[model samples]
Target: MRRVVITGAGTINALGASVAETLEAMREGRCGIGRLDIRDVDRLTVQIGAQVRDYDEAAHFNRQQIALYDRFTQFALLAADEAIAQSGLTFEGPLAARAGVVMGTSGGGLNTQDENYRAVYEDGKNRVHPFVVPKLMNNAATSHVSMQHNLKGPSFTVATACASSNHAMGQAFQMIRAGMTDVMVTGGTEAMLCFGGVKAWEGLRVMSKDACRPFSATRNGMVQGEGAGMFVFEEYEHARARGAEILAEVAGFAMSSDASDIVMPSKQGASRAIAGAVSDAGIPLESVGYINAHGTGTAANDKTECAAVADVFGHHANDLMISSTKSMHGHLIGGTGAVELLACLMALRDGVVAPTIGYEEPDPECALDVVPNEAREARVDVALSNAFAFGGLNAVLALKRA
Candidate 1:
């Protein structure tokens, strides 16, 4: 099998607009969650979110492009642009034909849908935008990325809730490793902080009113976030031949399903995925020094994930440092794993462990070294990023220093 490596990374999230900016924020242990600035904020019970502050869509897109591209698609394109530019890859000839795109998004054009629904239902409008269907499709982000980058090979979107990005990236890694594609533009995007999006999540009663404090005794619930993360996954040899700057190696990936609950998480299933990823990487449990946990700041997810890690790593679990970036960036839902993967890359590339910000008091159930409230400098050779989503879907990716 061909070895895979990450050549480039990009993101536009609550933390920052570029990979450099985001990593700086992570190093500083900054908190991005705050009072959301969106339409109809007065109507929602949950008013806080990690919104992309000071975003100027007009600065990034023209009139026609803005008309066709939804907010999620815009974010994907911006991030993809940065990744492709950083990679120094101009897809053409066979590379263009072999390169592809795979992205994940839970609500594709949620903002568009919210606007149209309000116009039609609340205002009693008879007609909607002609491009509403195209804009709101779940595959719109993937399709747009493919079109923009000229990725003519296999392209698709994954929609496994919070695990969507991890699953999509896992598939991309497999395709490259299997020699089906030499390169893949893979990641995820989400712009679901609109009125309808918050309303739907509010019904679940799992949203925090102010902050997201993952793995903390004072934690209440998760705060919603919006953003996109894009990365360039290339064959190791191909990258080396071109003298590309490798960020980190995609060592292994595994996914599993609980087959039990919808909203609740299962420790057994999460452990299987976590253990499977390490086994797939052919790395011993002790080699992993850090983990970007899927600590959702919820009672069920935090405890369940801690138990799963304890079960998988056993005694070694206590030795490894684990932290949740969700507390800083909030939860981006489908785009979360992609963003959280940044923490893993930081561990391998810079030896900097991103902190589980907002952690005030420790919970007995989650008694691991969470790197709480402050960033830490450590020699991390291998790191894992965990994404256990709704409906019991779990995906874990293991990374090694390049």
Candidate 2:
């Protein structure tokens, strides 16, 4: 099988506008969750979110592009620019034909939909923007990234709720490993912190009003966040021939579904995916030193994920370090796993484990080394990223230090 590696990574999230800034924030256990600055904030019951602040669309895009690109698309484009630049691979000629894009997004162009809905329903406006359909589509980010990067082969979007990014990235890894593509621009982006977006989630009653404290006994619920995390997944030999700086190796990926619940997570399904990822990587459970958990700060999710991890690794589970960056960046929904993957890279390359900030009193049910409150330095050879979404869709990716 062809080996896959990540040559470049970029992100524009609540923590920072670039990968460097984000890693720094993670190292310091900085909290990005704050009072959301969006339209009609007064109407929202849960007003706090990890919003990408100080972002001016005009600064990054022209008037025409802004009109056509929604917030999510814009975020994806910005992240892609950074990732592609770092990879130092210009797609042209045969390379362009062999390279493609697969991005994940749950609420694509949600801001666009909210605006149009307000104009038509609330404001009594008759017509909406002509490009609304294309802009608001789920594949808008993938389509725009492919066009901009000249990726002509196999480009699409994946939407599996919270696991969307992991699933999309896992597919990208498989495509390269299968020799179907030489390169893939894969990750996820979401801009769902708008008025309508928050309002819709408020109905779920699973959102924290103040802060996100994953795995903590005092935790209320998960917090919403917005941003993008993009990466360049390239065939190992191809990247080596070009002398590209590999961030980490995409060792293995596994996915499973609970087939039982639409909202609650299943430990059995999560454990299968986790164990399958390690087995597929050809690595022992003891080799994995860190995990970027899908700890949503909710009661059911935290305990369930911990139990799944314990079940999969048994004795090794106690030795592993698990932390949720969600406590710092909030939950980016579909874009989350991509951003959380950055934490794995940090553990593998820089030996710094990002903390599960906002954790106060630990829950006995989640009795593991969560590396809470502060970042820790530990040499790690292999790391895993776990994403278990609402639909019981679980995706796990194993990464080895490059």
Candidate 3:
């Protein structure tokens, strides 16, 4: 079988603008959740979120392009710049033809759509902006990254709610394994931190009032966040030939669907996905040293995820170093998987397991060791990232130290 390795990682989250800053915040158990500050929201019930405070669209693009692209694309383009720089794999050689891009997004251009509706309906404007269609398209992230890097092979976007990023990375892994592509930049981005987006999520009635407290019995629900995570995946030999810094290997990936409910997730879906990933990885359950859980800090998510992990690994659950970076960065929804995958790669490469902050007390249902409050030094070889979204979608990815 072919081996795929990560050459670079980049992420911009509520905690930080880059991976190093974000990793440091996670190590210190920093909490990004706070009172919403994007706009005046005193009238809203769910008033807190993980907003990236300093992302200036004006700095990222010219006024013309800004009018053409949404805030979500802006985030993705910024993240891709960092990822491409870190990869050192510019379109210089044969690697160009062998490279691709896959990005995931949940609420692509939703903020723009809301504004357009308000302009036409509420404000009674007759005409919309010329870039409305392009800005509102879901594939803008992938296209933007591909165009920037000049990648022409197998470029696309994946949208499966929060599972979008996981699916994107998993598919990239498969493409490289199948010899269809040699290198791929894969991840997710979301910028739904707008008034319209927040109200849309509030309709779900699953957001926390205070803070996102994953694995805590008193946890109200998940918190919304916006950011982008990017990774460069290359064939092992190809990366070595080009002298790229190999961070981790894509060991395996698995995806499953609940086929049950659109809103409520199922433990069975998570359990099967984990088991299938273990099987596909061709590794024993005992070999998974760490798990970056989908601990969304919601009642339904934390409980079912704990059960699924326990069922898949049995007694190993107590020993495995598990955590949810969401505690510090909030939930990125569709972009969560990509950021979580970065956490896993960092865990495997640096041997520093990040903490699950905001875990004041443990929930009985979530009895697993959540590596709470402080980062720990642990020798880990294999790590797993789990991302479960609405519509019964679930995706899991495994990474091994390269």
Question: Best candidate per lDDT, number?
Answer: 2
Error of 1 at 239 (Å): 0.6
Q: Select the stronger candidate by TM-score from 2 and 3.
A: 2
Listed in order, each prediction's TM-score against the native is 0.99, 0.99, 0.97
Which pairs clash (backbone N, Cα, C closer than 3 Å) in model 1? Answer: none
In order, the Cα lDDT scores of the candidates are 0.94, 0.96, 0.88
Give the C-alpha lDDT of model 1. Answer: 0.94
Candidate 3 C-alpha lDDT tens digits along 80-194: 8888889898875676778889899999988888889888988899999888988889998888788878898898899999899999999999999999999899999998887
Per residue, candidate 2 scores C-alpha lDDT tens digits across 216-296 of 999999999999999999999999998999999999999999999899999999999999999999998999999999999
Estimate candidate 3's alpha-carbon lDDT, on a 0 to 1 scale: 0.88
RMSD of candidate 3 to the true fold? Answer: 1.2
Question: What is the lDDT ranking, best to worst?
Answer: 2, 1, 3
- Alpha-carbon shift of residue 130 in model 2 (angstroms): 1.0
In model 1, how many backbone clashes occur?
0
lDDT tens digits, residue span 1-402, model 1:
799999989999999999999999999999898898989999999999999999999999999888889999998999999999999999999999889999989999999999999999999999997899998898998998898888999999999999999999999999999999999999999999999999999999998897899999998998999899999999999999999999999999999999999999999999999999999999999999999999999999999999999999999999999999999888999999999999999999999999999999989999999999899999999999999999999999999999
